[model samples]
Target: MADDQLGEEYTCRVCGFRYDTPTWDGGSGSHDICLCCGTQFGYQDTVLDGVWSVRAKWAAEGHQWSSPEFRPPDWEPGTQLAQVPDRWADASVLAFKLSAPPLPAMRTSADPEAQRAEVLGRFLRDGRLTHFPATGREWTIVLEHIAAGFEPGVKYRRLEIDKLLKAWHGKPADLLSRLTDQGFVANDDQYYWRAER
Candidate 1:
């Protein structure tokens, strides 16, 4: 899909709010926080499923203005949502990857902790993982770190799961799907939680 489909160049992917600047630039999010749904463009509103989850939450919460200072007196949710392009509304998983910047050369250490730290340093930014690691060992480490965020015995609603994973990666649904497939998380149709694997 064209990044600016339907003349939505400055539109919030999550709430469809128009902004002065483009939400995405050169395949990366502008990282501007949305005034309507409060979605941080590069973070919570990155992928399609994640965007949908944010929209759903905003709607469920009565469509409150995220930035009350900028909210117009006559603004309505239905009208703004109508501005969201069909590309976002009709899609399932729009796995849009923000361009991953190149990292410094690294050497694996003999110490397990050091090796893990190196892997994390390459993949994480401000506690949020930038992308899935290419190596199996590094990927498993990242997955385990993410799984640690959830409690083992407590069930989570789908929205709750999405929220928890939102800070971890842009593609929460994909992350959950991978976690479930690997038996790190289990779900019984509706509820999900960390599995005792």
Candidate 2:
């Protein structure tokens, strides 16, 4: 029989487990298992089955195209399609494992501005910035603590500048004014920080 005429057959090369056009409970296209070893194959593209006679041609044109980084090459004819050898299967599994990117290292900080920048940089790098909601004074406080090298997931009270100014009889404001005059601090929003330009 020509390969094109063959219908979909889920055959394990190891134990010779076979199923034909089986309805999978999960939407994912994974195979059930090997009849002999009972090892499960996650998923296979159903549309590509029997599209070509030679396994090599199917692998090159279909499998590789479907998953460029992880798909295994097609099995050769006369090769047992039922049960995959452990050694070869292990290599294919390793290839799939290596395809994922590594996770980022945890950050430590206490200063708000520095912490905020670091957190923002991490989110930007990992494409996770969108997960963060809008920024506010609470976020600013968190950033301050992070800049100070405080660990994440800890809470702290917000600083009240008015109390400090009252204790110094307005001396702190005078010093800030001096710094502003010297171009050391840029007064933009209510918060003061070093001038960017």
> Which candidate tops TM-score?
1
* Residue lDDT tens for model 2, 1-197: 54312322343322222333331334443443322233334433222232112233433453222212211243321233313223223333234333433212212356867766665653333322222211223233323322233223333222333333224333445434543554544444555554432
Among these predicted structures, which one has the highest lDDT?
1
Model 2 earns a TM-score of 0.17
Off by over 4 Å in 2: 1-5, 13-16, 20-27, 43-197
**Cα error, candidate 2, residue 110 (Å):** 73
Please, what is the TM-score per model? 0.44, 0.17
Model 2's lDDT to the true fold?
Answer: 0.34
Per-residue CA lDDT of model 1 for 81-146, tens digit only, reads 655765676332122122222222223468998877777777789989886653346666788778
Query: What TM-score does model 1 achieve against the real structure?
Result: 0.44
